[model samples]
Target chain A: DVKVTQSSRYLVKRTGEKVFLECVQDMDHENMFWYRQDPGLGLRLIYFSYDVKMKEKGDIPEGYSVSREKKERFSLILESASTNQTSMYLCASSFHSLNQPQHFGDGTRLSIL
Target chain B: AQSVTQPDIHITVSEGASLELRCNYSYGATPYLFWYVQSPGQGLQLLLKYFSGDTLVQGIKGFEAEFKRSQSSFNLRKPSVHWSDAAEYFCAVDQAGTALIFGKGTTLSVSS
Candidate 1:
């Protein structure tokens, strides 16, 4: 089974703080993704990395960035954590196949105060 | 842009009852479609996927979805629903396996 691990299951941060959310995949898949889920909004992609040091912006990429220093690890960075940025964050990894399903980690529920 | 639409926001059904969740997608070519379920406080779980050939695909937890090219729909269905089946369901479209566009989820509530 493919395991995607999120560093934190629940997080609390102060407004304007720099927040880092880490994700690691055991399968060594080439693609990793960061998504923030909100009520009534489903899940919106924040960023995705197809390979090490390569990143692409998703629909809701404002105020957020990502790092992929290693193939198995992808990091989501909140440049300036705001109250609106607080949400459930999910990380996923998938093989390069066109129809392959993404494996997800247990999400991190972040709260900004 | 590739997009997915889940028409029903929420649905309630009794245990042992047949259940169906509607999902529609808009794409130019043959779209890679998926259905995912999320329990409260948990991440999304892939229920099933539709690529090509077979129109019906069986998924985990006794769930299945059918792909209808004429309707541009991939609707999830189960012969009998259990209380444990209560969760939020999302339909998504993949852009050649690179990016995904998900729909606002449908919340399922199973009664006793």
Candidate 2:
């Protein structure tokens, strides 16, 4: 089975702090994505990387950025964490195809104070 | 713009009852549709997907969804509901080679 692992399941940070959420996928998939899930907004994509060092903005990309330094690792960075940025973060990886489904991590629930 | 819509925000049904969740989409051409389930505090799980050919697709956990081109809808259905079936369901459409566009989601509640 494919496993997408998030570094932190639960995290707490103060406002204006720089937060880093890490994700690693064992399936060697070429596509990785970062999304923030809110109560009514469902899952809004923050950023997605089709390959290492390549990133593209999604529907909601403000105040957030991502890095794909290696094939297996993808990182989501919060430049300045705020109370509004606190939400459940999900990481997913796919096999670089349109028909392929994305495999998701357990998710990181971040809380900003 | 291409988008996905899940009409029901929440639905409650008794155990052993038939269940159906509605999903509609707006796009220029035939779209790739998918149904995902998220258990409490977990990430989304792929319940089923519709690419082409077959209109009715069977998925894991006794869940299935049908793609109707005329209605532009792909609704999820199950013959019987279980307690463990309570979860949030999301319908998504492919964004023409980019990431998927997901709906707001429907929270399913199963009663005794």
Candidate 3:
């Protein structure tokens, strides 16, 4: 079975602090994505990486950035954490095809104070 | 741009009852539709997808969805509801590439 693992299941951060959320997939998929999920708003894509060192901004990528240094790992970076950024973060991986389904990680619940 | 809509924000049903969750999408041409389920504090799981050929598609966990081109709706259905089936459901549409645009989501509650 394919497994996507996030570095932390839950995290707490103070305002203005930098945060890093790590995601690793064992499937060797070529595409990785980062999304923040909020109540009523659902999951909005923050960023996606199709290959190592390649990234693209999604709909709600204003306050977030991502890094893909290796084929199996993708990281989401919060330059400065804020209260509004507090939400559940999900990481997903999929094949390079357009119709392939993405497999997701367990998710990280981030709380900023 | 592609968009998705899930009109119902929440729905309640009893166990062993049939269930249906409505999902509609907006796109210019043939669209790729998908349905996903997310449990509390967990990532979303793909329930079913509709690409081409057959309009009706069966998915994991006894879930199925039918694609309607005229209405642009792909609604999920299940014959019997289980207590463990309670979760938030999302409808999504993929336009030009791999990016998926999702709806707000509908929370399903299963009553005893």
Fraction of true contacts retained by every candidate, in order, equals 0.83, 0.65, 0.61
Candidate closest to the true structure, highest DockQ: 1
**DockQ values, each candidate:** 0.87, 0.78, 0.73
Q: Write the per-residue lDDT of candidate 1 for residues B1-112, one digit (tens) a residue.
A: 7888999999999999999999989999889999999999888899999899899999999999999999999999999999999999999999888978899999999999
Query: If the candidates were sorted by their lDDT against the true structure, best first, what order would they fall in?
Result: 2, 1, 3
Q: Which stretches in model 1 have alpha-carbon errors above 4 Å?
A: none
| Candidate 3, B30-108: lDDT as tens digits | 8988899999878888999988999999999999999999998999999999999999999998755577889999999
Interface RMSD of each: 0.8, 1.0, 1.1
Considering only chain B, report the TM-score of each candidate against the true chain B: 0.97, 0.98, 0.97
Per-residue alpha-carbon lDDT of candidate 2 for residues A20-94, written as tens digits (9 for 90 to 100): 999999999999999999998999999999999999998899999888999999999999999999899999998
Task: Looking at model 1 chain A, report the run of 10 residues with the lowest lDDT sum.
Answer: A95-104
TM-score of 3: 0.97
Ranking by DockQ: 1, 2, 3
Angstrom error at residue B38, model 2: 0.4
DockQ of 1: 0.87
DockQ, prediction 2: 0.78
